[model samples]
Target chain A: MATVEFVEATRVYPGADRPAVDAFELQIADGEFLVLVGPSGCGKSTALRMIAGLEPVDAGRIRIGERDVTDLPPKNRDIAMVFQNYALYPHLSVAGNLGFALKAAGVAKEERTRRIRATAALLDLEPYLDRKPRMLSGGQRQRVAMGRAIVREPQVFLMDEPLSNLDAKLRVSTRTQIASLQRRLGVTTAYVTHDQVEAMTMGDRVAVLREGQLCQVDTPLALYERPETVFVAGFIGSPAMNLIEAPLEDGCARFGETVIPLSRAAARAAADEGATAVTVGFRPEALELRGDGEGFAITVDLVEELGADAYLYGTAVAPAVSGRIDATPTVTVVARLAPKGVPRRGEKVRLRIRDDAFHVFSTKTGRRLPD
Target chain B: MTATPPTRCASLPVSGRRSRRRGHAATGWLYASPTALFVLLLFVLPLFLVLRMSGSDWPLLAGNQGINVPDNFHEAVSHRFFRDSVVFTVKYTVLTTVILLALSLGLAVLVQESTRWKGLLRTSFLVPSALGLASASLLFYVLYSPLAGPFADLMRSWGFTFLGTPEGALWSTIFLIVWRYAGFYMLLMLVGLQSIPDEVYEAARIDGASRWQTFVGITLPLLRPTLTLTTVLCVTGSLLAFDQFYILTKGGPDNSTITIVQLIYNVAFQGQNDLGVAAALSVITLLALVIINIAQIRAFSRRADD
Candidate 1:
């Protein structure tokens, strides 16, 4: 196993105005599974390809282990990639596909066969050894691709949305299998995907990217709990965190009739940034229903019942506070509630934000306010 | 009561569906009848006519007397020039197929990798294929002339005599054919190469496979169907070679370059003018082509199965 590092690596396409991956800098530890997660067109795939040496890095250096691989071809990088489409050689049988890299690397025939058999067994692909890639199902083809990488025993593994082609159920199961297999093998891996849940579940640490720039890199839980920017706070969760832009009055962020008292540190940080208003973010699970007299009122617009829990999507309709216009639009909020007590549509519910659960960010810069 | 109602409904729709399917099949045949008619009129009619003429004692300028079974076939097979022509045709077919396929594949791979000037290169390569074979033959005929050709003096200075001897004439004609047809085959190869996904090459590169290894292991195998087609076309087209030899060499240098088709032409028009023998030779050539094509297809299919 070896660590992979990218030092200010960037990729700019020809005739394009902006770099596809800009000033990307990250150092993955040995045997760690680091995931690059973002929406489409976010340059996550470009970053992974740079590491694979498939894409040329225009500006900076990349190192695999101690060797500078930025200028080297893909073959000399000692890395194996699993493509999104699996990309198994359609003409070669499963065994041939698995043994290809070993044969190419000039391994002994007997050793190649041994490693092929071992990888086949590890992937439960022995039964399909003689079958071509077209004969295998999508899930099996995916395993063959994985086996092809595993048989190489390379210094690092690069996977670009490797599970996207499988059906939803198979994608979930295969992702778990990949995560466990990576752990068992202890190989340094960098996986790129658009699915936040996949990144969260698979990576030891997930790096979030946006528009060719690094937004944040942290543990999945840490990113979910305390995102460094408003983008990460909104992008990291399933029912995305609700962000409300409200003016700060008397050291409190005012939203409709309810005034949330900001921490002294957050207020100081917001003041230091010269921001008169802040964006407050809270997760669906952080909002608790309370008695009508205790909390702000929300008119439920929709309720999604997910068996164990229900999420109420509604609009907060607090009465206008003094010196604030009633004409300002009410913000929509989603709250996770117990399935047993799901409120009906059009019902009015009072909700209170949990203490220390909300994040405050500067409205102008969208950076999180320190607390 | 439920079973009776469902059975009644099913019987009604079954009868309707049967008629509908029959009508659909009839319309399909109607749509296909034009092509079938053309094939029957153009292909089957000529095939039977040739077979009939082969069994007759017909001359080019005379009426057929009657069927003389085996006489024309016997004479055609026994003709002194016939054996030599068949052997020469086979040699030409083998040489042309090998050289053309190798050159086409090489040029195709070279052009496929280049991002700049790709269109210009492709167009230039394919331009010769657009020229009519007869026209191209006529053009090369003048160029190969020893007396008036511009290259004659230059070739003499270089100690080379193009089309002046048997081997020279044969190789000159082969070179002209390669120049004329390699582009067409290269186009076929280019389509095959382009259809292969970029990801496959990327995977191979990451596997540490060299360019040569990838070509042999991945590209050639995946391109089997197109290669098979180009090979069959090249073999058949070379076997039927006539216009170039007729125009440039005129089966000259002691008839060393005469192909089977040229021999058939000589028999039908220039020698005894025996249309019967010509027809017999045509039948033989057709049968040989069919057998060769079948053998090639069978070999390819077996490889595919493996």
Candidate 2:
């Protein structure tokens, strides 16, 4: 129940040219569930390991509560971690695995047994108290992993994709269990996962990382609505936001005949930044199908139907630009549609962007244009 | 109705599958027959011959005479040197097993932690295992010599005699065996240590376990299978100790280092050449080993169940 802070924490493997995690700076508040999310090799796990003190912090400092733990070992950090593989001691029974830390910390045998029994009850693992980890199902093993961390009553919890090994249905249920468990315990936690959906659903604040750098740290809705960079825009949401490179013309971004009107502030910001082109992003639910001659025509490539809603993945047809050879490549646009009137593949559909749902970023720097 | 047709089709392949399995089993036996034949000829035949010889009045120079039966067993049990050798074998087995397991486990942990020159150290440690036990024993014999060996001057300077006394001979032989086999046993324990996932150690570290606690709580328990294997090997190998003691001490300094195998060899070849009594001693040693091995296996399996 203490705040954890990473002040420019960086890690560079020996003989590697670049740091795995470079100048990482984040302050997790007390009782906050901060998730580090990115694709593989993005150093999200490295950042979490650094905070856990499992990884050496080659440079910079990390503080747990008020103590500098950069040079300290993991044992002195007073934190507990749930590994991705649920690394339960295979030889020990469930009770032994749960009470391992308490015993190591020199708790009396009686107290250790009491705490283990309490934790087993909380995890509904009473029946499995005498069973080995190999005998438990994946979901039960996952709870045991969580119980291992909870029994420590440490200052923070570090979970590295704890639910990744469970099946899909189990993963969903366990994700909620972990989230609510963290809330009930109110321990400051730093969780790392590559799955954006998991990060969006479980994190109080999601920090999206790319190429060993933090792209954006914000609430899930903020990240979905306004991603600071093109990477975060594409990485934060399911089915991802559609980004189109369009030319800036007449205070609007133009992609062939499809002219998306930008806010005055965005246009001014683009002009101020001296950006001749802009990358416009819109979510799948931000577009509506229209009649002919009213919107951009798209040739539907595929349709994914879910009970209530469907998504149309279509390649936008390049509209001829007058007196200009339109060299910009046509990009695919994904738009959500009502399940009732979903378009079939190879059919043409007209789509119009919602009034102010577009996110405009400069093409040169890939930074969001202020609006 | 639809399932009945599929069931009829499945039944049609049952005989074909069984014949194919029988053919596969035949090929497996065919592949294994050569080794099986070798074992029967080399091991089983000799075992039966020894058992038969133990019950007959067999001598080395003369052929087998009439049945001796319990006479050879009584002579072997009553022999003073034979009793002393059995006691000495038990002592050596217990001492060497304890020392070898402890030292090899320490060496394995040391090598596992080292990131630098690990291969060089491992190769250096395992190089002695490559030398035959007789060859290593002979080498150590020269090293233990007080007059013409490399360590002669050093031993003289330190006022120490390596194999001049019974305790010296015993420890010297134990040292030789440890040097020869510690690396091999270390490699076994190393495999067990490496197979433990790195995440387990990390979890223990996060659990605030000290290094010693980690070793006791995590490493020792997880390495139980390897420990059992190395313990059995060390005990059995030390119990059958003959080459090293024969080459180095020759039951030296008042016959204090006579192991059971050395006594059996003496009775069969050096003494009055009593092949019957030697065979009887061999049978007794084999029975003891079987009993010890069964007890060891039972102990390990019971612990595993718990």
**Predicted model with the maximum TM-score:** 1
Model 2 C-alpha lDDT versus the unseen true structure: 0.91
DockQ of 1: 0.85
The list of candidate 1 runs beyond 4 A from truth reads A317-328, B1-29, B155-160
The CAPRI category of model 1 is: high
Instruction: Kindly provide the TM-score of model 2 when superposed on the true structure, using C-alpha atoms.
Output: 0.94
Query: How does chain A of every candidate compare to the true chain A by TM-score?
Result: 0.96, 0.96
Docking class of 2: medium
Tens digits of per-residue lDDT, candidate 1, B82-155, equal: 88999999999999999999999999998898989888988999999999988998888878776678788887
Task: Give the true-contact fraction for every prediction, in order.
Answer: 0.95, 0.93
- The regions of model 2 sitting more than 4 angstroms off are A272-274, A318-328, B1-28, B153-160
Q: Score the docking of each candidate (DockQ).
A: 0.85, 0.78
Q: Against the correct fold, how does model 1 do in TM-score?
A: 0.95
